[model samples]
Target chain A: MRFYESKTAPASKGDLTPMIDMTFQLIAFFMLLVNFTDAEQDQRVRLPESILAVPPDEPYEERLTIQLASKDVIIFAGSEFSSLDQLSRALLVEKQILEAREKKVSDTTIIIRADRESKTGKVQEIIQACQTLEFLKFALRGKQAEVRVRSPSN
Target chain B: MRIRHAGREDTTELQMTPMIDIVFQLLVFFVMTFRIALPEGDFSIQMPSASASATLEPQTSPTLQVRLKARADGELTSITLDGTSMSDFTDLQQRIRRIVRDSAGPGESGSDREVEIDCDYHLKYDYVIQAITAISGYVDPETRTPHKLIERIRFAPLQK
Candidate 1:
């Protein structure tokens, strides 16, 4: 096998402008990607509204939101979990992070934004997962004062 | 940042290799995590919570238990407010309002009667929300505020 040497070829400068541009673009992309983590939530679930439901004014010290959708789908922080074990395991990791940060595990509130049509059992299951992790604080999400039609009269 | 070739070479070239490698890694990370369309959950919503064994304040007021029974297909079969069965959500709403009125009668300080929602495991959440709506009266759309029948509401713990 003959290997051609480029020693005789004219020394040329490959433009680094594109690489720099692409890198900047990527950095910007990931920066925006992470800044907007809320974009990954499943939108199919319609939230229930309550007159008493108030929007939180204070930022969470540390928070995790769980979205429960129809057909038994449980999504945590943008990843889907099919079983309670998976959900618990993932929650344990979050618990450890809080622990390492010198924060109390129970202080980490798990926000549940379940679809209005989702099974209560499923929502309960997610709560149980948080409870198992010793994270007792919870925030259940509902829209504020939504006008909904009453159930059909029999 | 560019490095100068030591003594003889006059050319100054930008250090592209390392920067390019790092950029690719970042691009890959962002691409892997990019989700094209996830629209909702933009604004946060807050809900009131109650513990299973939480005792009622102003103990004279009864804790209303709204039980929802469902068929195998997830259709709501019955909604009983404290064992009195009702046909639909409106009936449940009326009964709940009446109970609230009685508990916190006029010419008296409103009673903070607690409500516990106990739902069948297989029931669709639509009905549960409906029951919640029934118990939680809507705002007069024009007024944007409606008095709640029961101020303290919580989920009933499953019977183990």
Candidate 2:
């Protein structure tokens, strides 16, 4: 007696479509999270201290940084202004320019980095100048003081 | 029937290219808006802490202001009261006591006389505390009585 055998064809395809879709999603997630620093910025000022201080952990875009050095007030995006009046004008111009180009200005903020040893009068002047230009929001930069431990000699 | 069988095994593909592009765009937007804040220095003063301290009432006019400058030799070289220079610490102490005493009434509290102390940044911590102690009621070592003269001492940073 002879036995009859049946032959079956194997599945031809393994799908890579799901993997490609997942890879694309991952790429998108990282792309949305990356923050880019503006090139025309300057941040070289000593900050004041407090009893409770935390390091800043924000992304760097959409900020206008103002750096106050020993003698001059430097605008990060534009030219340095020697006086508060000049800085005010430059701020106004920049604000208008940004609004005109972007058609929106709600998210922009100003950052003031003044040296810790600088006078309060100067810092107030800068604040007043910014207020006049309608740049009401500001972030004051400051460093966390280092803690020291005392060892007792018995 | 033949056409229906041919369509049964058809596979549909979803393109993720546009979704990926939009996600990258949002990431770039957030990254561009990130701000790194620099430190601000001036007027960041470490005030000496006191548990028994009370806040002062607002002054209608400028109170008596005393400016104390500490020299490199660890001595208070100059003392100015309300823009007028005083010759010695004794004189400064006397002036403060007189102002506080004159301001207080018989039944009124001594908190009205506010003394503002403008200290130099380079001054030693001990010197600052000493100045504060002096401005407030000084305790006579011999009599051991705390004279309730000056009511409050305000610490102001020196203006550059």
lDDT of each: 0.69, 0.55
Off by over 4 Å in 2: A1-42, A52-67, A74-80, A87-113, A117-141, A144-154, B1-3, B21-160
On residues A73-133, what C-alpha lDDT tens digit does candidate 2 reach at each position?
5554557778887887787888899788883343555666665445444554665566555
Report the error of model 1 at residue B134, Å. Answer: 2.8
Tens-digit lDDT string for candidate 1 (A97-145) = 8888999986676778788777777876777777767766676676555
Per-residue lDDT of B90-112 in model 1, one digit per residue for the tens? 79877877776744322343336
Off by over 4 Å in 1: A1-37, A44-54, A57-59, A143-154, B1-60, B102-111
Q: What is the DockQ of the complex in model 2?
A: 0.09
Q: Fnat of each prediction? A: 0.29, 0.07
First chain TM-score, candidate 1: 0.68
